[model samples]
Target chain A: MPGDAWSRWRAFAFFAVLLVAIAVLFAGASALYRVPPAAVVHDVHLRVEGPGWTIEYRADTTPNSTAYAILAEAADRLGFVLDARRYVAPLDSVLVESINGTRNGEDGLWWLYWVDGAYGDVGADRKALHDGSDVLWAFREYPPREASP
Target chain B: MNVRSFSLRPHKRGKVPPWKLALLLIAAGVLGRLVLWEMPNVEPVMAVALIAGMLLGGYYVILVPVAVMVGTDVLTYALGWSGAYSPVQILGLGAFVYSGFVLAAAIGQAYRPRLLFRTRTIAVMARISIPATILFDLWTAFGDWLAISRHPPMNWSLGQVLEMQVPFTLVHLASSLIFVPIFGTLFLYLHTHGWPMAGPSPSGTDDSGPE
Candidate 1:
């Protein structure tokens, strides 16, 4: 009986050590791959397309500019309305609800963005810009959940 | 009577029949997942899985969690909460999440307590919950990485994955810590009292006594 108890305790200790190791690894990864703060002005290509209208522009912004900031700047340069709001988790970030007076889910249409062609999982405000990055915001019918941003 | 033939039946009795217990657990898990679908990461299913494993033992430890996951996922897909993943993606993600829960329940089964809800029992559950939650988070995060890697524009890196996973993992851990002891204690009382069974047998039927 004592031996059994000892073995159980040993097993518990092993798992405990394992969990601690993972926690350490996670922290280390975060620190090591931390997104560097933006340095120097970044040249970003921006495209905004919606039903019956398409706009293209280029903007030079300070380093560390977020996707949302870039979008807002592009909208300003093109004289269009950009509507956005802050959302809570599991989407704890800025959400662009509408752009150029086109509303999200308006007639089965929603605002979706892609950074360099891949769907952005993190919110616009959270996605940091890199120099020469292509940010595309399209107002299109929402895709199936499989591919929807 | 042949000893082998007699051994086929469950000679050791439980407050509830194992099959029925497994069903009830699956029902609870499905309901919890549905009601809490929008909440993301904060769900009672994990605690229920652990509790079921601890009390029910044997195959129920694994089947209960898997059934709950599959059942709830079907409902989530039907209800349009599948998050736009293709059926294949959903199945892939489900595989990872299901494996995590199964591993967690397996850990719970290792408790092998003679009596439920004792101080030592709760302590052991608490100890197991931490590592189990971490394991679950890591497994699902790997699933997330797999899905994200296919995307073209998204900057995919280990650091980004870790940073993105931190908040979700923390919430999951918190949910487990809160739910395990609470549900474990409540269900322990119910099982000891023969809840959903006829009545509490004054002479306990458990073969394993306090270690």
Candidate 2:
């Protein structure tokens, strides 16, 4: 016996509609969450502040440059190791685990980044940068509200 | 018994004890989380909670999901497998996560009378899982924003937090859409047919809806 009022056709129709709705939602989210394409950057300043040490570099980067991309470029030029891992959604971006042999969680500090003195809201790879952009990667505990810069 | 024989022959009504059913559901839920730990937000706990409510009803609606979540939470924390949280953050986040699953169970409870071991019923349950998943994700995302994201290196506005949550919620919806119907049918089948290990029902009655 059929369980409820729904016929086989109705159930199929419902599932088809549900799947389409999900696909629409996925597309909308992808569009909304997408970072705008980055333009070629000239004279972008990058800084990495680790425990008792700081490294700074100024470089021109190709179009579509991101904070992480510039950091990787700087690391290659400066000969410092960049340790990171790519996580899928919800993160859907690379996480910097260590830098220059200093791993995150050392001394209760993790790697965080800021662009132009504003803390990065998205992943480093998603933090688009333009010419004259200032990028700072710092190893520190999360700042209290009053202490945030 | 063979798969065909086991599934085809419905067990005598009231043969499966409520405790056994509850225990099995809770175990399935916890194990699902443990096995799928690498896949964030893709676990059967939500489906199991919903089924528990529909099958066992009453207090089992609350007990089953809570046990699964608390059990997994404790195990993960003890093993240091999950994220680090402060005492306050733990309580705050726990409240949201726990309530989310309970709400799923509540939805199942509401549909208890209508739920049946049939294709149409399965479809309905699967459809309901979408909205249930959205609600749970939204609620917990807000909790995350409140407890963690609002502070720190990323001072995201509520809108930003919600926008970021979209992808995670989509993945969660996919997980639920797959699990709810499968688990719902399986549990409803078991409730109808009574498991082999099931002892006499404590209540000597079948409170779960008609087979």
Candidate 3:
């Protein structure tokens, strides 16, 4: 019945809202940098905390693909092999939040902040960051080191 | 003598119609594409296709993925995901996968796509994976290279471009492995359980349209 069609329409609308909300959330939470005025970024800082010593290093400058593009780029770059079930958004959030959020919560001791050296924060808008800003990445684990010798 | 008079038969009400399954699966395919961004980061279209695969089986896998790609790609460009990897390049990725998906659909049609763990099964999956991944990956990576090289300031070279691919490829592989099975298994299970809205055959084949 045409009247019964409303039910289906409502369902579609409900999901449609959900989809939009998610898009908005990602839009809201992604790491960002401004172009032209700031233009190029040159450095990011990585920090690792564990056991006894805290280590920090500067990473080379790079441009991020924004929040939406992170997932596609991340899995390809970082070799992340988890079951996303084709749902990159949720995982992407988990990833971005992991990279973007504070390195502490209730215990105030478990988290990572910033990203790939560019100062990253979920609270920061892409348009706000300037070039050469330090991105702070924090980890509880000992940071992996590439063997050069 | 009375025993000879009666033969017992079980009561049956109604057999569900095929159109119901078709409409339902089609809707699911559409919905999957619509909600595809919710899925983890694989190519958005692949997410759509995977969900559709989980819904209607591998038959319309390509179409479903393409649908999500169309939507997200539109949104992305509108949001200024432009430059060298502009809309054309993004769509090119879709075009590239079409041939592969068509092949996949045909294979799906021929085989019952049982959740078999035979060597052949793994090989079949890998065969589908290898080409499909490469096909989609090249379009995207090429776009990335173009964007970087064409950026008047730094015209990067082939090695530099390829060198830059280290991280991207890793992520793609991760996303694909993650989604493909979780989805493929879900569809297999639904078909196996004789889901009321599932396992509809169009003629002799197991199109198994969802409901």
Which of the numbered candidates is closest to the native, going by highest TM-score? 2
Runs in model 3 with CA error above 4 Å?
A: A1-149, B1-44, B47-62, B75-127, B143-151, B191-211
Error of 3 at A143 (Å): 34
The 10-residue segment with the lowest total lDDT in model 2 chain B: B1-10
Cα lDDT, model 1, residue B28: 73
The predictions' CA RMSDs to the true structure, in order, are 7.6, 7.0, 19.3
Backbone clashes in model 1: 6
- Cα lDDT of model 3 by residue, A48-69, tens digit: 4433545444435545423223
Model 2 spans with C-alpha error above 4 angstroms? A1-28, A35-38, A89-91, A143-147, B1-15, B152-155, B196-211
lDDT of 3 by residue, B136-196 (tens): 5565556555643434223456566555444344445444444444444344334334454
Could you give candidate 2's per-residue lDDT for residues B95-173 as a string of tens digits?
9999999888877766554534466667767766777788889899899899888876567788988887877787788
lDDT of 2 at A15: 69
Model 1 agreement with the true structure over B1-211: per-residue lDDT tens digits: 0111111223254666777667777887788778876565777778877876667766676778988988887777676445434556667777888888987777666644564435455556756787778888888788767765434444457567766777677667656766676676666665665774565455344554454
lDDT by residue (tens digit), candidate 2, A53-135 = 99998896556379899899889889999998775554357778888988876775778888888887777898988778998
How large is the interface RMSD of each prediction?
7.9, 3.7, 17.3
Error of 3 at A91 (Å): 12
Docking quality of model 1: it rates as incorrect
